[model samples]
Target: MKKWFLISTIVLLMIINTNPASAISNAPIHWGFTKGKNEQQAEAGKAYDELLRKHHAFYKGDPNKKVLYLTFDNGYENGYTPKVLDVLKKEKVPAIFFVTGHYLTSEPKLVQRMVNEGHLIGNHSWSHPDLTQVSNEKLKEELKKVKDETARITKQKEMHYLRPPRGILSERTMQLANEEGYTHVLWSLAFKDWLVDQQKGWKYSYDNIMAQVHPGAVLLLHTVSKDNADALEKVIKDLKARGYTFKRIDKFK
Candidate 1:
């Protein structure tokens, strides 16, 4: 009986190991990249490129195209989104806003305005938890809540893009997200601009952006930063002058 029990236990372990989900690493990866300069594209290195590509994710667009994709994280409103929206309206720039459940509930009108004004809304998870640490069911729940709430509020039936909460992800999370029809939208350009209390100035935001500007760059900005709102208009005008056309995420190649 003891010998048979040992054999059964070994077979169970083998079965668990062979499971597809179990085979992928759940080790969390905090997304980072080497900054691009002189108008060259930023490098996410080979491993990140491979992992992202395999999951149909996007960090940047075609390297040869002087096209930019602008995205904002809306975890919570800080009374500056209106200014940002106004700038986008004036300059006719397109952007995607990744919103959390809190944002959806707390600022439904703003979210509706986003859709009404031809901007795309993306899922930033329900509670903004580190997705790599959540179980498959929990992850699904988190995503579902945001998607459903977004649909209810904006009447936008499809939510295809997802920016992992806190920029944390893993192979397991990516695979799960892909299975849910969410294409992970990572960024190729970002800075320490999310800190609300540490905002330097509008020029600070502008300078960092100008320095990192590149072909096919995807920029991640926080709506909570007053600097971003203040500098947005000039940034758009200047980037346009530099011959960079801002494109919607859906139009990205």
Candidate 2:
């Protein structure tokens, strides 16, 4: 009986040791953080900072440089992206747009325009599902579909960044994304500008950004917000006057 019990324990240990899934946590994390104020850097807390660091994810760049990275989450178009693009073009600033599969299929022209305008198209998953619930195979399928379709439409050879759907992530998800050659790009500055119905005015968007602006900030904006569209050019001008240089995601260091 003792021999049998020892054998069972050894089998259990072997199973635990061999299974990588058993060692990694898939707990869903709805990304949130302490917002920066007065040019102070935002903090994602010690635990989250360590988690991102472990998987080579980035929320902001070097804190000493007066640099800004503009990123947009394009889950679905609401007709304001063209205005946002116009502002970027006029200001000579670079930005990245994390797009969904729906966006890819429905707005291929805009996707091509994004590539043509020298902006990046990042993966926001094929269906915008909570990635923590997906299997390894499903996750790979999701990422590949976006990359493949974006390449097909835009003729852009490589895609390299991902923003987990609904601002959700986990260690397992980040690891899976990194394994598939994509880095997680979270933001250091954002606000409630995504609610199309609740927009106060262009000033509302501009104020939130200026209040949170800091060295090495990654600003996440939604192209669907009309206020953001109206406020973008002024925001760019003001930020430039403040000595902040806009940069692309690939240039982060």
For 117-208, candidate 1 gives per-residue lDDT tens digits of 88999999999999988899999999999999999999688999999999999999999999999999999999999999999999999999
lDDT, each prediction = 0.95, 0.94
TM-score of each: 0.94, 0.94
Off by over 4 Å in 1: 1-18
TM match of model 1 to true structure: 0.94
In candidate 2 the C-alpha lDDT for residue 13 amounts to 92
Q: What lDDT would candidate 2 get against the real structure?
A: 0.94
lDDT of 1 at 49: 96
Candidate with top lDDT is 1
Q: List the residue pairs that clash in candidate 1.
A: none
